[model samples]
Target: MGPESAGSAQRSHVDRLYHLPMITPQGGRRSAMVPDVEVDFGAGPTTVPSTMRYVDLTGNGRIRVPAQGAVDWSQLNKLPECITVEWSGADRGVVEAVAARQIRFLYWHDASGTVDLTGTGVTDVRLDGIGLRSVRLPESARVLLLREPPESLEVDAPESGHRMDLRLFSRGPDIRIPGGLSRVSELWLKVAGTVSASVLTGLTDLEELRVSFDDPPGVFADAQDLQAHRGLRTLQLDDAYDWDPGNLPELPSLRGLEINGTRRATATVVKARFKATDVRISIHGAKSEAWLAAHMSNPFRDWVEDSKPFGAAACEAYTRARSAIEALAPTASDRMAVAEHALRGLIAALNAIDAEYQLIDTLRREQAGEVFFELAAQAEVPVDQARRWFADRDF
Candidate 1:
């Protein structure tokens, strides 16, 4: 038999499943049969004849295009499939053309540099480490996995249509989420710097939110920011264990709350506050009684009490350290190390004061003698002054 006869016999199974169109002339069909491309898309296996310059595996509803320098989709008649566009070289036109074909899913991987998916009819997109500057996700977009920051990002949402459920992993001191796309239902932001609450102001209809706060106050400052989210149901506060219950918002719509890194005193208040409320609560890293005992044993807490004389000394130390750190040039690399050391001292002083205050507050509320004497002896003030202060107290 001739080469064409053998090629036809080899491709007979794949041809029956997916017709591999011809790209070469009938005379040269013999040489084209040398290399056949096999692809698997869940169902089983199918091969493309070497004769065709391109293959259309979209018949099975999935397409995996390797990183070719440039691809002509028109060669395969532009089938509507969930296209996986892997990073090869610059192929803006190829991506645009595929999007223009109104494909439902676009899995963009390893493609760096600026990418603009403005008019893409893609509904679900999984983007990995793409330097996305101009991002205009279609209103049809429902799910998105954005794992890296674009130099600049702007989402152009369709005026009247479906909303997007986005998971963004971007870090910054000034992270900007465009005011446009307001239909985000669920948003999970794993940010490095403190993200302003204003970023989510327009997403009023948001239901679930998970965020990491370098400073929890940034999110708690505006009550209306979370209160305005009438549809909000779940909120996960990551790295907010140090947060006090007083800073927590009164979101009537909130049903589930998750808090991590909670101090024992703060955790107690949080649990008490949420007990009567319908919101289900979960707490992690809550300090145990032993943790409280450890603090009580420290002499610094006793010395940092609300006594006016102690306050005066503490204030001077804190102010002096802060001023010394601030005097250094902000741009200097050594400034951070100096500032960090100064801040450490300041934090220790502040923590001592906070522990003393928390202990006093707990004693006032619970009226337990054990709470008073635990750190009362550690008070750095004169023994006589400490006695007078503790004796006069109604605990």
Candidate 2:
């Protein structure tokens, strides 16, 4: 398909905005470093700037350039390992500049046209809201996350001892696995159309695989092809339709299997097939209430289990929060409002018990955020609004 068609598919597939956290210095302070000679791209041609603004000097070594002006990179005294450029008109010169500096992580937003990173030392790359028709990656590239699949992709094999992680979230039916991605260890394909057995041809080292169909009638062509992936440990299938699990290979290394939004009969067959194995299976959507109650436990129960005598207050607080959310009327506005209130209550309870440190020190804040999002999703809350429920959180 053409870029226009692919772009349309992307919009439908990803209806939610992802708010990625930026790395900042401790105490939430940021110092701006302006370029030595700031040349206006809108004006006549001039020398490339030697320095750039918004360079994170102290923390994780990052440079964030906005989409307003042209950035012709010049040699800097200190180059950051992570660079984020939010320009839709970035071209080959930008790629060359980044390649020369050997950036480690690159987050390019709203990039357009073609760009090649032939010999860059970048280990991780994330392309979000891109309009590129093609992209070429160097052999040193390890992790690639694409919000929209490009019309053409050329990825060289990773260096020795390095494995690639390829994630593509596309709604197009023409999503093809590139040839040189044989070293990919983790693959996530959230797309449409039939997934042929040839798609797994060289993915022998794949450890984790997740396939989610965006449209109905899209199916996996063959289950026998999965036998080659002996290292596969985790497999997730979401919104799967017209797919059979009866002939699935016996993956001895499989530990976690999840099948969501599929036919109830299919789910039952899968359960029966893996009932004797040690694999932890999770089947949801179009399932019985009894099955759901038995399989899906409270999100905070694990936290309560991990904490003992000192966690009594936290357990009580989380229990109340869960109850509050569960008691909300099945309305979007009510869910959003009640979820926000419950989250604030939980945070207050934590602060009252002098356990706020646990939220930060033990990463309980992330857990709490995920729990709230899960509850919100279950209630059909829009992801963007649900995400904002935690915006005013104190803990």
**TM-score per model over all chains:** 0.47, 0.52
Judging by lDDT against the true structure, name the best candidate.
2
Instruction: Itemize residue pairs with steric clashes in candidate 1.
Output: 241-261, 241-262, 302-379, 303-380
Q: What lDDT tens digits, residue by residue, belong to model 2 across residues 234-279?
A: 9887656568897688888999997755666788888888887889
Alpha-carbon RMSD, candidate 2:
11.7
lDDT of 1: 0.51
* Model 1 C-alpha lDDT per residue in residues 1-395, reported as the tens digit of each score: 11233223423432332211222212443574356545543334446443433233323223444343344445333222324333333544656665656455565555565556666766666565555555566656776656665646556566511356667766556555444557777777766535545667667568887776433322333334576777889987655434445755678789998765446676788789989889999865454555434432222222222343443444454455546554766467685455545544544554465454332233222222222333233222244443344443331
Name model 1 segments beyond 4 Å from true. Answer: 1-68, 72-89, 92-105, 109-121, 127-131, 147-152, 160-162, 213-224, 284-395
Number of colliding residue pairs in each model? 4, 0
